[model samples]
Target: MSWKQQPAVVSAPPSEDAVRIRTRSGIAAVLFLPALFIAKVLLLATDKGGRCFVDDIACAPFPDTAFGALLVAVVLALVAAMAAPVRVARGALRAQLLLEAAGVLVVLAYP
Candidate 1:
């Protein structure tokens, strides 16, 4: 090639292996949302209900039935999320995130 018309350094698209790795990573990241939700629910259920502690301070009590219901909902959402395809999974993930965020916001803002 002439100096004025040097050959272009074209790059090949990602190989199948690279594409597969990327897809796996994407799915893993997406799945993490549901996993996180489930973990939080389980942690909350197992841990004692409390806001803070002091020399003789006590935290507000919450109902077991309410907590149990919350756990059930979280588990259901997790199952749906796992079963969904990548395209549908995104919607489920967004919904779970939104619900969690909204719940937190309401608690903090109201309480």
Candidate 2:
């Protein structure tokens, strides 16, 4: 390689800690969104006879580690708020959330 071409130093991939920090920051951003943050309370309150499903609310942000936390969180909140009959949705939503949590946790732990 020419001296001028190789003059600058090569950059390394971000450290695991840095990557995890960035991921957490991104998740934090999702959580700080006003509407998303309050989704649990609103969904439960508006739910008539516990018939509402996660799909009722557009699962915004698609499926990602950061947003997944929000999804699981909202579900947990709703489940906690529900009475005797827990109407947890029956589909990939729960599984997806679980996967996200696992993925994020792995990243956080080993990134």
Candidate 3:
């Protein structure tokens, strides 16, 4: 088709709810990961069975190295989400939240 024959494209501006949701999601992406990580850390530290064999003053139950790495990854993902373009930030935050929710469920369900 010739350029003159093609119709012009029109796109609607994003609604207030959509922008609000994205803004809130971005803020949640920035906040929730650290809170979740802290909660997990507290849970691990308070589990009496995992107590350290050495100096009690300097020791607490240490979660798996993999878990620590996962926490770091979540933080990095949050940073990425915040830096992402407006259109992408919402999806990034949603995906991060889904991953975090799954991680929380796994931690809770583990025997």
Candidate 4:
């Protein structure tokens, strides 16, 4: 038998729900200060020293540690939202917005 290569196939564009989920996730990642708080809490719980560096000294740019974490979280949230059959894109986006707003308020109030 002889083997032959087949041409590439073209798939349809992503659905509206997929687009919405991706857009929301992008927005969440852009405004990641809220996720910083969550990441900090988790770090404090898991690691007594929460320092990113080798030494135990505190770093001023500590919140920068959450950047990658928040990006991954946002991507995961979009994936989860896409998996749901009910298409709750708006709800997911709204919840993210609310959380971000609350986080901002808390940060402002405390600091």
Winning model by lDDT = 3
- The lDDT of each candidate is 0.49, 0.42, 0.60, 0.55
Ranking by TM-score: 3, 4, 1, 2
Residue pairs clashing in model 2 are 16-111
Clashes by residue pair, model 1: none
Query: Which is better, 2 or 4, measured by TM-score?
Result: 4
Candidate 4 per-residue C-alpha lDDT over 1-111 given as tens digits, one digit per residue, 9 for 90 to 100: 999999999988778777767676676757676555765465545444344334556534434345445445545555555555436755666555655554444333321
lDDT string for model 3 (1-75, tens) is: 656667888988766656665676667666765766665566556554134322344453345675667666666
Candidate 3 has which clashing residue pairs, if any? none
Report the lDDT of model 1 for residue 45: 48
Per-prediction tally of clashes = 0, 1, 0, 0
Candidate 2 local lDDT, 1-111, one digit each (tens): 655555777888655544444454345435444434344445445543134344444423325666567556645533332311222322223443455455444333321
Q: How accurate is candidate 2 locally (lDDT)?
A: 0.42
- Of 1 and 4, the candidate ahead on TM-score is 4
How far does residue 13 in candidate 1 sit from its true spot (Å)? 2.0
For each candidate in turn, give its C-alpha RMSD to the true structure in angstroms: 13.2, 18.3, 7.5, 10.1
Give the higher-lDDT candidate: 1 or 4: 4
**Candidate 3 — which residues are off by over 4 angstroms?**
1-22, 26-63
Each model's TM-score?
0.36, 0.28, 0.45, 0.42
